[model samples]
Target: MLMRTGVALAGFYFVAQGDWTRLLACFLAARAAVTRLTRPDEEKPHRLAEEVGREP
Candidate 1:
């Protein structure tokens, strides 16, 4: 999430500088970062078994 925000800010800086190519690249990078951050974590198939074996 923080990384995404940083990328967005960088993109804004590029826009302010009139660097269109860099701005586009930054936008794409930010979009991908946000997408990855928002994605759900994959479930571990053996989680229950592992938990059951962890008795101290």
Candidate 2:
């Protein structure tokens, strides 16, 4: 959440200041932040199945 908010603030700041280079870097960081935000929790199904298998 922080990363996303920081990126958005930086984007507005950079655009307002007409700083193209930093804005491009912000865009790159945005890609990573969005990817992280969208990724699903990958461990839950495996853990659930293992626990079920172990119960009598």
Error of model 2, residue 6, in angstroms = 17
Worst 10 residues of 1 by lDDT: 40-49
Q: Judge candidate 2 against the unseen true structure and give its global Cα lDDT, from 0 to 1.
A: 0.72
lDDT: which candidate is best?
A: 2
TM-score of each: 0.46, 0.44
Taken over the whole model, the C-alpha lDDT of each candidate is: 0.71, 0.72
Candidate 1, 1-56: lDDT as tens digits? 99997976865776758777776776787789888778765633357667788623
Give stretches of model 1 more than 4 Å off. Answer: 1-11, 14-16, 43-56
Distance from true position, residue 35, model 1, in Å? Answer: 0.6
